[model samples]
Every structure is written in C-alpha cells, then in structure tokens.
Target chain A: MRDEAALMRSARFRAEREQDWIKLEALVAKAERGGVQSLQFAEARDLASFYRQATTSLAIAREISLDKALLEYLEALAARAYLIVYAPQERLGGLIGRFFAASGPQAMRRSALFVAAGFLCMALGGLTGFLLYLESNDWYYVFMPSGLAAGRGPDASTEFLRSVIYDDSPAATGLGAFAAYLFSHNTRIAIFVFGLGVFACLPAILLTFYNGLIFGAFYALHVERGLGWDLGGWLSVHGVTELSAICIACGAGVQLGSAVLFPGQNTRKEALRLAGRDAVKLAIIAALMLFVAALLEGFARQLIQDAGARYLIGWGVGALWLAWFLLGGRSRR
Target chain B: MSLSRTRPTPNRQHRRNRRAARKKAASRVIPPEGVPLELPVASLGVRVAAQLTDLLITFAAAVSILILLSMLFFMYWSTVFALGALLFFFIRVPYYILSELVWNGQTLGKKLMKIKVVAHDGGSLTTHSLVLRNMMKEAEVFLPGTLLLTLDQTAPWAVWASLAWVAMAFAIPLSNPHRMRLGDMLAGTHVIRLPVPILLKDLAIEAPRAISANGQRFTFLPHQLDHYGGFELQTLEKLLRAQENRMSQSSAEQNRQAMTAIVERIRQKIGYADAVEPDDELVFLQAFYSAQRAHLEQRQLFGDRRANKFYADARPRGTG
Candidate 1:
C-alpha cells in the first residue's frame, strides 16, 4: 500500500521522540497541579529547557505536520507555560495590607510639603473669611451659598443655631440618614479635591481654601452670637479627624498634580500612574478617618453638650489617630 | 556580499545635517509608554444590564431592611429608630465595598454579567478607588434624582445645577474614547468585558486511510522536519481550519489552491523525493502534520527549539 512506508516512518518518529514528550508532559502536569516549587531545582531546569524545545517543535510541526491533535496540544501547553512564566498577579489582601502598613505612611510622609501647602491655603482662607464676617455679618452670605448655609446666617434665630450646634436630640430625619448624607457629601468633596489635581493642583488648592472659608464664616457667626464656645465643642468632637482627613486628601491631590506639572524623567502618564497609586493610598486612609469622624459626630456629639467633655473626647480621638499614623504596624524586631 | 554591502550609502555629510534632515521629515507617532493599543471597552447594552442587576440587588436589600426595621419599630420604637439610623447610613456604601473587595473587583451583578472592574493600570482593585467611584454615584446620580423628585418648587438654580451634574455624568462617557463614566474617570477605573472561553466542535477528525497511487508516500526523514517552528505550526493549523468549512464551491476552490501551494512549498523545502498526487494533497499534509508535530514536541523536551536551536545548544552547560 502507498501509505505503508509513510506509516512506518511516522511510527519510527514517535518511537524515538515520544518518551521525552511524555516525560515533559508529566512534568508540566505535576508542576501545574502542585506548583513549580514541587520540583527539585534540576527538575525545574529540565522543565524550562523542555518548554523551549516544545516551543521550537510547535513551530516545526506547523510547517508540515498533519496531526491537528498534536498542534492543539502544544498550543494549550505553551499557553499554560506562558501563564506560569509571565503573569504575576498577587493576592489582593496581601497588597492592601502592604499598602496600609507601610507604603501609605511612606507616601504620606513624602508629601509633607504638599500637606503644609494645603494647610497654609486653608488657614489663610479661614483667616480672611473670619476677618470679613467680623466686619459685616452679611459676609457669611458672600462666603457660603444659601443652600449650604441652611439659613445659619445672621437671620437665623439663636435657638435654631444652638439646636444645630448642640442638637443633643437624634437628627429629625434619623441620625443614620443624616450621617449617611454628610459622609457622602464629605467623600464627594475629598474625591473632587484629589481627582481634579490633574489640572495642575489649582482646583484642589482653591477647594481647600473654600472649605476653610466656610469654616471661618461659620465660626464667625457663632462667635458673634456669643456661642463660639459651644460651636468649638461641637466642631472639636469631629473636627480633629474630619478636617485633618480633608487636608490630607487635598495634600494627596496636590502631590498627584505635581507629578504631571513636574514629571522630570517619566512620561506624564507614567508619572501620574505612579503618583496616583500613592495618592490613592492616602485617600484610602483619609476615607477611613472620615468613617471614624462620622462615628464620633453621630454618637458623641449627639450625647454630649458640655464643652469640656466634647473637647476632651475630640482631643482624645485626635491623639489616637495621630499615634496610629505615626506608630501603628511598625516592626519591633 | 550581503545586500547591505552592495547598497549605495546616503549622501548626508555631517551628523548635524542628518539630524536636521530627519527633523524636516514627517514625524512618526509612537504610543506613549503606559497606554495599550487594544482593549475591548464593554458595550453600552451589557453595561446597562450589569447596572440594572446591581440596582435590583441593592433595592432588594433595602426593602428587606425596611421590612425588618418596621417590625422592630412596632416592637420598640425608640431603640429601633436609633438602630435604623445607624444601619441606614452604614449599609449602602459597604454593600458596594464588600462586594468589590471579596469578589476581587466583581460585584454579584458583574459576576453574573461576566464583566469586571479593573484599575486603569490593570492591577488589583484598591479600596480608595472603589469608595471614591461609588461615593461619586451619590453626588452625580442619586442626589440629583432625589432632589428633582422630592422638591415641588425647588430653587431654579438648584434644579439647573442638578441638571448640569446629571448632564455631565451622561455626557463625559460619550465624549471619551474609553466610554468611561464620570466616576471611572475620577477613580481611574474601567468596566471591562471578561470573555469566558466557550467550547467549539472538535476540528481533529481522524485522518483517513488512503493508499498512495504511486505506491509510496513522500518519506520525510526526522532531520528534514525541523524547517519550521510553533509559529508556523499555528499558521498551518489555521489554514487547515479555514479549509474545514468550505461548503461553498467558490471557497472550496480557493482552499484547494491554498492547500496545493502549501504542500508544494513543504515538498520543495524538505526535498521529499516522491511525487505527491494533487488529489492526495490532504492526506500528504495530514501524514506530515502528525510526524512533524511529534518531532517538534520531542525537541521541546530536549530544550532544542527550532529558530533558537543553535542559540540554545550554544549555552554553556555542565554534564549532569
């Protein structure tokens, strides 16, 4: 028969080479199932060499081979090898823990200058707003929109103002609903301050300034009404963490902006990606702080009306946060 | 001599002149470092489906809580009210967060839809991005809709402001190449289509038994089978597949020519002495395919790949 010698030649090729292919196949199977570490060093080396040879054979087989089955097998095998060789996605929790414990603080420390800059802008704005509001009560209207101010301007009755600052009662709409709204509002502001840093940090700086302006205008209103002490107690209960979180967020944003504005060696995109990672870590920490701040505001501020007690709680919470950032998760050994 | 040695040199006299000349020419565009050329942005239909699924899920949870809270309120009004406050504020955001976290960037809805959220760097998802993007949904989507629905005589400015925000939310995606939502842009994330592989009918039908008319098959010795590599094998497989479904006469003719040309090229390259009948072309390729595949796979185990066979063999190694 015409196909008899061709069959003999095919049979002979298999007889000679089939053993090694079988060996390599077994090794790959064992490695995939138990991990490549299961192999001894020499065995692992063999796998690598076998992979290269398999890659070559795949090419040669393509040129003239008639076995569709063999080609498919090699194709799948090579893909598995490729995955083991190249893709290195790590466990998500490990990465998250790694970020929080070390990289987050490291990044925060590196952006100290930006933090100072944000604080300065906020402080200046607060001072300006305070000075103007003192000159004329109408300046509160100029600084804060009517909607945001919630008629807390000069026209608001003292009783209404007192209720807002020391409203020991559960929020009319349910404390949770109010807290949720406030948290969402705070989160949105932080994200914008961070995200808009791509525009050369101008928007972030201005937003930080505006935040301080509102704070200053609010403080001035309370001070004018002879309720400045009450407002301080109320704000202090959450302000230590809440305001710091905002400042930290703005700092992170400015850092991201600077990556674009002063990318020295990397392309702007690469610089942004690198800075974005750092900024995101800071934002995560800030978001966590805001959660804690909301907790204090919801429970402590609602229960405590004494100025001394509120101040004590506020300072205590602030100290805990400061210590955590500086010292938590540090290695002893 | 090699072709380059025979070619005439260019006439630029100085390095500066050559540089200037090159500068005068049209610039070639290269992709900036981080951007990848090809990624399939999820279509709007699938995105909407995923979103609706998530909305339904969130709504169900909220309703379940509402029912429970109502029961609790009947039992103890004051205590339940306080508990309700805490739950209402806390539940919604964490639902999104915990799902994304545990699922590794897939919510239950996203899993059902076979899509995933990925950080733009195509790395693991971060808590900050998930939080930021979801919080933005409150500002950009929910809050506006709530205000519009709740207030009968909302300030004209408030209505316009809400409308402008909603417009921005919808408009940003349409304006961009990535079709990214506003939240995605802010968080540097994307909803990507994750295509799970589907099965196909097996192409590996058994090789037929056919006698060569010449009483001989073109015998390819082992060494001669080393001309091509895996890349070529893939090409050959593709060609065979392309011929697999040639039901139409027109396509069948094209396939026949392609098969004939490929067989002839292999015959010439390997110096197979026997003449292969055109009618037996398929059988010839099939026989060669089996032998060559076997030979290549064996070579792979030995660390002797074609194209790089010489380079591999040249590496210094200790005899073990």
Candidate 2:
C-alpha cells in the first residue's frame, strides 16, 4: 500500500510538471537552432521562467530521489538554459565603442612597465648596432637584409640615397600594392612576436632587438654617406607609429611570459589567463597602429619631401598616442 | 517460468563497469544559481576532426579567393597578388575569432560537430579569451606547419627544432584530463560535447494489467519486488526504452533473447514459479520493473535507500 502511494506521488509530480518541461525543451531547442534572437519577447520571458522552474524541479527530484532518467533530463535542461540565458548580450556596436574608449588604451596603459622594458631592449640594440656599423662598414651587410636594403647600402652614393628617400614618382599607382604588402607582412611579424612570447619571453625580446638592429644599421649607413637627415625624415613619418606598434606587441608578449614565470599567489594557468586579457587588448590596438603606419609609409612618406614637416607630423602623432594612452579611458569620478 | 540463466562472465562485467564509470566522470560546472551541472569534455578524436574540418574550410576559402582575384584583376596582377596574399594570410585569424564571437563560442565546424568552447570558470565567454586563444594557434599550429612544409630546404637543427615543437604541441592536450591545448590552457577555456535532451514517457503509468494474451496477468508480490533496487530498475528502464525503438530483424531477435535471459535470471533470484508465455516476456518485465521501482522509492522515503542489488542490506529477502 505504501509502495502504491509512493508510485502515485511520483506519477502525479511528473503529470503536473511534464508540460512545462516539454515547453522549455522546445524553446531551448529553437534557440539553439536559430540563436536566442529568434524568440519573441513573450517566448524569451517564458524561457527564463521555465528555466527557473526546471532548476527547481531538478532540486526537488534530487530530494525525492526520483528515477535516474528524470534527474538526468532535468539537469541537462537546466544547464542548457543557463548557458543560453547568461550568455554575453552586448551588441557589436557597443562592443566596438567600449573597446576603443576604454579597454584598448586602458590595457596599454596598465602594461606601461613592460612596454618600457621593451623600449629599453630595442634602444640598447640600436646603440650597439650603430656603434658596430661605425666601427666596421661591413656590419651593414650583417644587420640589414639585402632585399630590404633595396640598393641603399654603405657603398650606395649619397645622391642615390637621397633620391630613394624623396622619390615621389610611385605615389598613386604602385603605393596600394606596397601598402597592402607592408600591412600584411608587418602584422604577421607582430603576431608572431606576440605568440612566441610564451617561451619565457626571450624570443620576443630577441626579435624586437633584431628589428632595432636593422633600423640602426640602416640609419648608420645613411649617416656614413651624409644622408642621415633625409633618411630620418623619410623613415620617421611611419617609423614613429610602426616601431611603437612593434614595441607594444613585444610588451604584450613579455607580459605573457612574465605571467608564466612569476605567477604570484595564483596558479600559473590563472595568472596567464589574467595577463592574456590585457595582452590581447594591447595586441589589437597595436595591429590598428600598424595599419596606420602602413598607409603613411606607402603614401605620405613618398608625397612629403620637407624634412621639418615630416618630423612635425611624426612627433605630433606620437604625442597624440601618448595622450590617448595616458588619459583615454579613465572613469569619471 | 525457468530457463537457462547464463550470467555475463566476471571479466566482461568488470570491463563494462569500468566503461560506465569513465562515462559518469563528467566534469561539473557550478552556475551562479549554486547548482552544479555536469558537462562532458569532448574526446580528442572529435576535437581533431573538428579542427580538420575548419582547416579544410579556410584552405578552400583562401584558394577560391585567390582564383577569383586573379581572374578579375588580370591586368593588375601584381596589385591583385599582394591584396590576395593579405587576404589569404589574415582570413583564418578573423574567421576563428569572429565566428566564435558571433556564434557564442561555436565556429561552423564546432557547430557541425555539436561541440562548443566554454569558460572553465562557468562565466560567459569573453572576447579577450577568444582572441588570446586563437592568437596562440598561430604559434601552436601554423608556425610549425609552415616549417615542416619547408623542411627539405631548412638545416638539420631547424628540422629537429620544428619537429620538437610539433611534438610538444601535440602532447600538451594529451597530458591534460580536459584535453586542453596550449591556447585553451592559457585562456581558461575547454570544449564540451552538447547534451541531447531525450524525453522518455513516465514509466509509473505502466501499471500491471489484469489480463493479457496469455490469459492471465503477471503479478509480483512485495517480497519479489524487494529482490532489486533503484539502480537495477534504471538499467531495466534503459533496456525497455531501447526495445521501444525500431530495429533491424536481426537485432530484434537478439533483443528478444536478451529479455528472455533477464526474465530467467529474475525468476531464479525472486523464486517466482508462475509460467510466463514466450510472447509475454516483455509484459512480465514491464510489470516487474514498475513494482521494483515503487518498492525502491518507498524504501528511500524511510531512509533505507538501496543503491543497487549489490548493497549488503539489499540481499534477497530469504530468496523470496
């Protein structure tokens, strides 16, 4: 007799609640098939209410020790509902606004120390390369790739170097291809530097310093031929943006490496994850900077010839970047 | 209703038990509501297959884009080539990051495979994590992959270095229980197999009948029902559910034989003497299942819960 009562209680429980379960299942299935947006306002509300009810039922089922199958079904339903309902709902427009106005600059500012370290490494590498090139002209061949040198080497005449830097002939037609190539190539290198930072940050530092050596050696070659001022004007127009972007990428990589190496109180994995948040934001902003640099390198540098105007524009952009990082995303008090 | 009752060999039963234990060891994620939910981690094989599907898609997209560009801008082939190269180089990066972002952690391949990435902390999937994880893929997969393609031209030490990197990348996932690659480990994300919701009808409604084709009802006394427990009831329920689904004639024959063996074993254990007709085997099992379930639930109410037939206190009551 007691057995019969227990059986009837369970049956009645299911009979009373099964309809809601079926309804919730249908709503969840629809959402899964055609995203959460497909649901009407009423249906979405219904989904939330049903999800709560299902969770309650799951709790009750555990208390009463209902059959295993019913408990499993309820658990699955509640989990699916939780994931769908709690998913991040910010639209793309809002996300973009938040990224630029807050996350991007704020993340770059937060990692200022690492960025400084990155800058220091590059500067020391530049000094070393400059001194080495001055000591022996053959260091130019070692530091700059022949292809990238493009006939501007220690042996190239000062007039030829000036012509190369101030050349305005290939401005409109071939600049597009040049810009595309530089954007893709430099972005690839930046991403590579960032990714390889996981191996204790040495590789990231080495790559950044190697790039600096190339820059310093090339500049020294022009300084040797008395075309240093012209080359500086030509390169700075884009180098200010491009080199800073690469430094940012290197800093992000170092952040990852340091997180792994010195994972304070948290586990190494957790530290790496926390660091990745800011590092990735820095990486994205760096990529954007690279895009701007690519445009300036391909078009603006070719069109502009005055050394004074070039320095003004390059340093002006640099100052703007500095201001943006320092003050872009501070919350209003 | 006695028949030959051959039990499964102990070794086979042990192996089956181990497999079930492994299946039951799904990871639990606790939601904000304080309820812990079980989510099964995807198998390495399925993850690999999904990755292959994604790679094939990206490769096909890049090749088609190249061909289309070459055809349209034949006169400006140089510019087209550079633009095409940029598109080809960057397509996979955005394809992964944006698809995961827009689809809520599912790429087209992951959706097809019915798997998705979820945060290890049970929070919403963040855009930062998605970007970070996919960025690491450049190091984990593409870098070594490109190196291997140019192995014939590279030095011996470079070949070894690339090979070591490839092996390390492959081994990271295998080393972890969740099968997380380097990116997943760093991003605090893991992939999970989605559950398929199956709604089985209430079994309590299948009360014993008064009459059947055999001209009598199969009834179980209280002592007979006490021979099993809730775990056995669940196993019986699964078998019955499987029987309900349509199957080929050969499998149907095998199912019938399996049911006969089960019926024979129950009779022996409960000492039931009534003869159940061969055609009425399923009816007898169903009647026995509901009765056993009711007995277990009543015991559970009195705080004398029996986990399975193997529970020491749940030994047959004087062999019925």
DockQ winner among the candidates? 2
For model 2 chain B, the run of ten residues with the poorest summed lDDT: B149-158
Candidate 2 ranges with C-alpha deviation above 4 Å: A1-9, A63-68, A137-147, A150-163, A168-176, A183-185, B1-26, B48-78, B89-98, B131-170, B207-231, B302-305, B313-320
Lowest summed lDDT over 10 consecutive residues: which window, candidate 2 chain A? Answer: A1-10
Best by lDDT: 2
- DockQ value for model 2: 0.39
- What root-mean-square deviation over C-alphas does model 2 reach? 5.0
The per-model lDDT (C-alpha) reads 0.66, 0.79
| lDDT per residue (tens digit) for residues A29-127 in model 1 | 676456556788988888877766655655555543434555455555543443233222355577668777776777677677887787787888888
Chain A agreement with the truth for model 1, given as TM-score: 0.76
**Candidate 2 reference-contact recovery:** 0.38
Q: Model 1, stretches more than 4 Å misplaced? A: A1-104, A168-178, A329-333, B1-66, B74-320
Worst 10 residues of 1 chain A by lDDT: A79-88
**Interface RMSD over true interface Cα atoms for each candidate:** 8.9, 2.8
